[model samples]
Target: MAHFTLKQLKYFVCVVESQSIAEASRQLHISQPSISVAIKGLEDVFNQQLLVRHHAQGVSISANGRRVYERAKELLRLSNELEQDSREEDELVAGTISIGCFESAAPLYMPRLVAGFKRLCPGVSIQLHDGEQHELMHGLHRGRFDLAFLYDLELESTIVKEALNAPHKPYALLPADHHLARQPFVTLAQLAREPMILLDAVPSKSYFVDIFTQAGLSPTIAYSSPSIEMVRCMVGQGLGFSVLVTRPRTSVTYDGQQLVQLDILDDMPDSALIMAYLRNNQPTRATRLFMDYCRTVELAAVTPLAASA
Candidate 1:
């Protein structure tokens, strides 16, 4: 016989999810004492501290509690699946999946992916949120996102990453008429002489700076923008050139100024675009289906002006 009942597991999971016993009790429509007893019973069964409670603040789940919570979620999922199987075995795939997308990639791929997924599975709906690398990973742990579309840069160990087919190689963004834009491939040393518009987003900023450092050159940064479009716009207006990984389909900025993409003659590292989710957590049916769909989708390659010639 199992030492703990589903009620105990539910209460414990709720406490971890809601981050407070009072909140869990209110959410579950159970009395505080009942929820507290259930939590204590779980700790007694496991013989480990499940939660570290704060007097005035909320509680934090211990390492052991996180493990238990993961397994409990799986158990609850299976149990729910079994119940659903009995009720509607032939039901169509349908659920709301929350996805966290990297801000830079969102504009490039999200619209197409969302539209295609909806067409393929009209029963399913996708809720998309865009954030930086760290924010996306944080949302994954907090159960706010089922999956995240992010680069392989600076990933957490707790995240299980599946690399997509997208190839994200850093390329130079220059005005269509820039003298260097005519070159088949430009080196960092050549571009370093010109003013640079840095993409000043967290990991992106560091990643771009490292490329110059590796090339034994430093750029004269004229401007920095958190917005990728802003960086592109600044470069398009001939303010300066910038290095970016994501290549939008069009080389034109929002203002219709044409920009040019050129391969870096100097060796530069490539970052893989990946789909990441919690390491041990089982994906929902909708999330699993979406992952499958993403694998077959072909990502657009970076288009260089020289290549088109």
Candidate 2:
């Protein structure tokens, strides 16, 4: 029988995932020698050369190492579940949950959600990361995040999603003084003729472009940005109009410029915000509680965004 501790497996997994003992050491806040010893101990127990170490370049997992790494991840997940179950038996939930959120939606939703969840489960801590859709999805697959909050856009078959809110129609953003600012509603055909400031983030850029293509129109993208606020600031400066679903409470930009929101007259697909997790990865007790909290909470009501147009 192989006698090894979970700590050894954890260290080994971290080194494999990070691809460097030094990098894993930094992440785990342990010394490089200590991590190396843990890896060596695991290798000795299994009698397998699980890693191919390179001088200063990092390390690569051997074929056998790859298989072991997968099993290690599963074991760690199961161990976490078992620990959570034991903690729950005491009627006190305590653990940390890592969450990934869409960058644009994070500012609007995460603050309130995190605060409320923490109040309910004071024993549980949260670590949140916000990025683009691809980044968030990558985090989910890599096991960096237990779950993610993002739009239900081109998700993989392995991802299971729960809708957090009804689909929201996208609105056009324009400078307050623009010609079409006073219009109660606008059409894609009209906006198609004007310069467009595209939100260039992955999935978002493609989604907006698809919307125009579906309408048999192509926007003249005069400028593009990955940051939502930067896109809004450009619109406020009369650079170009933008299409967006996440609306802030105020019509002003960071530079004190005012913007206008107009409903799109054309029938377009609505966007749905969702909480997604991997189908294979079971949620810990704390993660399950947070997921439940998300389902019951009125996220839109707590956000500072204006009512949908």
Candidate 3:
């Protein structure tokens, strides 16, 4: 049996990411021949080909290579976490904590989270990455993110999630003086007839549509956008109304038209926000501290609606 080093695994993952041994070598400041030797050593140890080489065109990962790549990333992360967690409690909490957040939630909460956690643990630093739910989950699994803030929707079995204190329910966004603006809450059936400005982000789009479907109502979608501001702008223009989970602190849209928010009275599915990490990995000390900080902070109070610029 061939013995593989952590260095080999690291080199292998870089090769897969960079798509070629030459690129990985350049990025890592290692020689191309050295990376090739490491890769050959890995292939020998695994008894399977990890990459397919082409003379002019770059290499491609084999199916098994993809699996190994994911596991290798996880192993590297676990190793790093172990080193961080092993530090003395009295020692300063110092290290970079990589976080992935849902795009919709990032604008609302990242600054507060970073600032608050840094305040409590001055030695710690935070790195933030924003993506849709699926993208965030993928990064978490790939070990690109140490932790993530995501919605409790369409999550994979391997993703372990801790729900935040508040469960965000669907709410209506309408032009300030619309006929239904006086109502405290509007039902799906009530809004079914109105043109809808759909927030077209993944899982969000499906989840919102399901709420209408469950209510035996179908909304007439007038516009769709991945951007929350676009949806808000559409609503402000009176082109349609939108259903949103995160209410911006600002009641005004980008165009400066005032908008109104109404609760959804119908029994609709609410999306719970969560702090997620890979199921099998152990949390580092810094990760634990940040998670603790996040748990104590209430998102609503920290992230009030702001004037849309």
Candidate 4:
């Protein structure tokens, strides 16, 4: 008979996912020796070498460990579901939901979304991870994130997405004093000829570049950055113009320089913000409630700073 606690399985999963006992310890707030003993106990019970320890580097799962890890994850998930199921009759929903958000959209929406959701389910805890589209998708596959808030771009078919809001149109951004700033709207041809500050994050880079390519034009890239704020700051400095989907409430950059938002004269495909998750993995009760809350919120509301094209 296998006698092991869920805590042991949790510690083992954390070590494998984090790839470092030290890291798992920090995340779980447990001591290294305790985690080591837990893993050793599991190894002893099974009479197998589960991990290949590389001194000072990290541990890698052996063949048996890989199988055990998958089962452990499923078991942990079932355990969580069982707990939630038992509390279904209660008015208070309590559990943790891990979410991954796109870096560009996190600042604009996460703070409000998280806060609002907490008000409805005060007993629930939320964990947020913000990164590029690729990173978020990877986190989903690895079971690190229960849900992901990101743009509907270049996603695999296995990812199930629920549209969170109406499609958002991409618009041109420029310094307040740029040559084209006086115009109410700008065309791709007009902007293509000028220096472009590209938002170089994955899927975003290809999406922006494709916008010009589809119109038989190519932007003259003067600067490219993964950070949206950095791209905005460069535009504010009049280094180049940029096209972005999400608009901050203020038109001012972090450096306090002003920017002008202009409509795109040409019709383009709109970007939709979506709640994504793995199709095979069912969302927890708390996650489903948060998802429902997200659907009711005005997630697509942006300041009407730009004029009609």
Ranking by TM-score: 4, 2, 3, 1
For 1-309, candidate 4 gives per-residue lDDT tens digits of 878889999999999989999999999999999999999999988898889899999999999999999899899888888887789887668888999999998988999999999998898899998999988998898788999999988889998899877447899999988889998799999999999999998889999988999999989999999999999999999899999988887788889788888889998887888998899999989899999999999876566454223
In the range 38-151, model 1's lDDT, one tens digit per residue, is 889889999999999999798999999999998886786566445534534676777667899989889888888888888888877788999888888877886668899999
Best by lDDT: 4
Instruction: State the lDDT of candidate 2 residue by residue for 1-309, as single tens digits.
Output: 879889998898888878999999998899999999988988999899999999989999999999888888889888888877898768988877989999988898888889999999999989999999999998888777899999988899899899896337788999888888778889999999999999998788999988999999989999999999999999989999999988777887999888888889999887888999999897899999999988887755323333224
**Span of 10 residues, lowest total lDDT, candidate 3:** 300-309
Query: Candidate 2, which segments miss by more than 4 Å at Cα?
Result: 301-309
Better of 1 and 4 by TM-score: 4
State the TM-score for model 1: 0.74
Structure candidate 1, residue pairs in collision: none
- Per-residue CA lDDT of model 3 for 79-196, tens digit only, reads 7666666665657667778899888878888888898888888888788889898888877766668899989998888977898875488889888878887787788888999999
**CA lDDT of each candidate?**
0.85, 0.88, 0.84, 0.90
TM value for model 4:
0.96
The residue pairs in collision within model 4 are: none
C-alpha positional error of residue 206 in candidate 4 after TM-score superposition, expressed in Å: 0.7
TM-scores of the candidates are: 0.74, 0.92, 0.82, 0.96
From the highest lDDT down, the ranking of the candidates is 4, 2, 1, 3
